[model samples]
Target: MKTILTAATLIATLAVSGAAVAQDFVQSGTTPTLPQREGQAIYNAVCSGCHMADGRGAEGAGAYPPLANSDFVESPDAVIAWVLNGYRAMPPLGSIMDDEQVAEVVNYVRHNLGNSYEGSSTAADVQAMRE
Candidate 1:
């Protein structure tokens, strides 16, 4: 009787552990894919001149700011707005890029240099901000 009870308890513990592991696997597997892999090209064409390839801006003595360690990239909505509307010295990109392209570039910046914050920006978000 004692052995049977111990075996049942052990089995229950194992089952709980297995379920926890499965949940972790599912969560990690659900990360969304980035929209663009040609992030380098997009950056070069649009952003590199100002922000630089390393995401460090070149305005003046610590004036332009660097996106490499920026907190702005962590928030999808904030980055989207800044990209579309422009910041202090940054020009608005909305005129140049459509919603889809904006999203792709946003994803590129976020994943490639934005500390891998793992959030995706949508076209709807951009349009709404414009309105």
Candidate 2:
């Protein structure tokens, strides 16, 4: 019973901390409205830590590849696969995010962050890639 209670307490604490971080993210307006721009939300929350707000990656312990004007970011299908399986350095986001979330973030990165690609990826596309 004591162990169960402790586990519950830990879960609740994690929930509250996660909420706090989300609240802070909302207040910052770095990600914007999730309903409207889930991609930006994921990017700001997950990618911005290493990729930077502008998507210009840096070299520290490992190379954080630049997304700005990077031809490597062209294909949405390829991008989805990379996010799900990870290429190198970047950990696979599929473990943490759903297909829709992956699509949104991929779309966000494609069009924004100094990119001008005329293509976009839908949630359906991400779902297909996941399968």
Candidate 3:
């Protein structure tokens, strides 16, 4: 009986914690936003899952394609389009992220990752592309 009671208490505690976490994610009933808005912050939270923390991509069953010193990252528009529209294996992040976020990530990839590209993209550019 003591063991059963302990198990039940643990389950109840977990349930309450989970509910609190879920509530934190909710904002005015609309879709929740990312924790940070900075370019690097967004990259670390979202892009690094596949592209890796160092910006060097991975390959296993499928290739993630390296972003380090790649000519592809030179063009801000191209990177933005791919991120918003989705590529071969990557899913589109258009709906998940706002225009500013798309631009920030694009700019982050362009300037960092061993690729020194000229000029940074603006939110306006992303919005124009979306339209």
Candidate 4:
């Protein structure tokens, strides 16, 4: 009985902590901002929540499509637009991130996360998409 109680307490504690971490991603009344400016940093801080740290994605409350070896990520424009405009269950994060940050994340997701796409996206490209 004591062991069961301890397990229940651990579960409850983990649930609360997880919810708190998830809240960091929510916009709330104002737009939430991420301090990381680099591509890999931004992806780890923001995208990794749903996409997972390994970029394998997750499925629980919702379905988060994987970024690994994905054809969808080949188009930098599409990823940039999706990040800015949001897609389906994904929230639009343009308000929180600058153009450079967006480009960095695009490049990071494209080149890393089990992807080996060539070329890079410039901040100017991200700015153009914003317009």
The 10-residue segment of model 3 with minimum total lDDT is: 20-29
Off by over 4 Å in 1: 1-38, 59-62
**Model 3 regions lying over 4 Å from their true place:** 1-32
lDDT of 4 by residue, 1-131 (tens): 99888778867754764574466545445535566778887887688777877889766557989998899899989999999999999999898998988999999999998899988999999999998
TM-score of 1: 0.63
TM-score of each: 0.63, 0.70, 0.74, 0.78
For this target, which candidate reaches the highest lDDT against the unseen true structure? Answer: 4
Candidate 1, residues 14-95, lDDT tens digits: the string is 4764464444323223333322235565565567555766786654323656678677688888888888899877788776
Q: Candidate 2, residue 65: CA error in Å?
A: 0.6
Clash list (residue pairs), candidate 2 = none
What ranges in model 4 sit over 4 Å off? 1-33
User: What's the distance in Å from true for residue 116, model 3?
Assistant: 0.9
Candidate 3 to native Cα RMSD, angstroms: 9.0
Candidate 2 displacement at residue 105 in angstroms? 0.4
Tell me the TM-score of model 3.
Answer: 0.74
Q: Ranking under lDDT, best-scoring first?
A: 4, 3, 2, 1
Error of 3 at 21 (Å): 17
Q: Judging by TM-score against the true structure, name the best candidate.
A: 4
